[model samples]
Target: MTRYYRALRLQMQPCGISNHAAAWVTTSRLRLTLPTSTSTPPRLQACRNSRSISSIALNRTNPPESASTRSKDGRQQQNGTCAIRPANREFSTPSKVGRIYDPKMAKLWADTPMSLISETGYKERSDIPPGHFAITAAQNMAHLHNVIIRGFNASYNQCLAVKPDTVDASDFLFYNQGLYKSIKSHHDVEEDITFPSLVKLTGVQDIMDKNIQEHKDFDHGLELFRTFVFETDPKSYDGKKLQEIMDIMFPILHTHLVGEIGTLLDLAKYDSKKLEEWWADTSKKARGDLDVFQDAPLMLGCIDSTFRLDGDPRPFPPIPAPIKYLSKYVLEWRYSGRWRFNPCDTFGKPRPLAFPNPGGSKL
Candidate 1:
């Protein structure tokens, strides 16, 4: 699959096809059938006629016909809207109102208004029943790391979408800086405070050794990524090069980010009280010295409060109401241009990408 994806990417280079089209081509082939009479496969056909494939991809972004409207029969289908109807109503008759809930048909968000952050394909750490300390702590870490993942992907995709000659480089420069600072700060806190605290709490010297080594795996790539963006003058800024750096770093970074959550979940075997103490200390240290203007915007811009997991929407980062208000109203103004590439609004509402690739999914 990886080799085929790579081959598709190579084919895309000359065609100037967007990532969405490539993904569509790749995934569609699994279920799609073509005329055996055709000499060229549809995958190659798309590359040969880019505009047709682009149009097909763009059409997918149109609002899907409502679930009720998609029934094959002429009968009106009962959907979420039918729940509010009177129980005695003819249309609300239980026998005729069977609703088959398919996880495959479900959406992560109730309303998808934009090009969503690419899914990492890693299943989220499940919520512990009644919530263990491990689950609580891991949830916090997962949310924080989620911000990094989405922020990085949003920045990466936008860089790919826009030509260097067209957009101002400063926006990307500052945007990259925000992504760099947030990710770097996260790892630094883990290594300096969180990991040591874990060892002390568990009395197991290498309790967090694996996670630390995982951090090291991507540290150099992340540093190089950071240095490249910060050091490269905006006059010579290359979005493509920035993307290349991200391409190398993000996979390793993503693996660590996702794997570490499982590590925290494994800590459920430890005493809850001690884990809680460690969490209080580490979480405090993590939030320490936060630059409201810089950090808060990135968090708000990346989080989608509407994203539903375990049948519930996730609230934003647990901060004071005043802090949330101040960050949304005032601090966000500082890097307002950079946030144009952000996947969400100040209130964590998903919004259309400011620079979506041509024919990309706008959901």
Candidate 2:
């Protein structure tokens, strides 16, 4: 074994992940096959017959694409990393194979016509870290996903509900950047802060690996979605084309959005005080990561539109009073030409809903 192999072994053993195959699985790029039972950690093993330095497993770099994966038209899809699955896995869901393309169905069920349900008996509970914080984070992330999806829907409906024609490229660009930065920025911080903190506290290194993989599974989709918006000329922009890309991207994104809540709630067994402390610290990191000019307006606006200060037990980080004023009036105005496409108002209230959510009357 080379010195690098010995170093790798020394680094991982103390992390509680170097027991066997689990160690190899955590450090390597192999797809994890987690057991149905949560109690048992997955088994893995590493071999150290290093003929060369490159032969040793290292932190994964984005893998290269294969010739066999080209579209029949002889062009590569913008992000060629996503592999489509054949209809064969016994345990896989429909989304595992490919998207079920039915705009009507998606709108009908998931994004139903808005019928205002009052907070008649909604009781907010106090949950300590791990579970409480986890659920809250999941809920907020899901809310952000909903806001983005609805914004896209509204933009599409405005331009092409009845027919497709010229779209406002400026609007599309703004929306694309807003949505992209919002989701990506949130995720980057969580990966940087929460996952590592949780691991340190619990001494279970692989606990958050599943969530990391979920983020990975959707990367190509986001890339394709972004590329389609940026690369296509506004004059040539087709609503159907946008719909198609969204259909390709959203199923995986949606699953990740909601799936993470349950995964995090499972961590309640850990130390609550430490988890809570970590949540606050991680939140600061997330807030600090937000760029005042580019990302602040979209993120703050979306949060304002989705999360309620009055009802939500945990208030999201507040924009300091001075920055809040400047961002709301000056900075947001600079970049928010496309907020007309947003489903909710800057304050998080429903502004007549949007395209996907049938604009229903209030009681």
In terms of TM-score, which candidate is strongest? 1
Where does candidate 1 have its weakest 10-residue lDDT segment?
Answer: 81-90
Off by over 4 Å in 2: 1-167, 286-291, 304-325, 353-363
Model 2 TM-score is 0.55
| Pairs in clash, predicted candidate 1 | 114-362, 114-363
Model 1 bad stretches (over 4 Å)? 1-130, 165-167, 287-289, 320-322, 359-363
| Clashes (N, CA, C under 3 Å) per candidate | 2, 6
Put down candidate 2 lDDT per residue, 237-314, tens digits, no spaces.
665676566667666766665566556566566665666676655543442233334554554444332333224423
Which lDDT value does model 2 have at 297?
54
**Model 2: which residue pairs collide?**
20-44, 21-44, 21-45, 22-44, 304-348, 305-348
Give each model's whole-structure lDDT: 0.57, 0.45
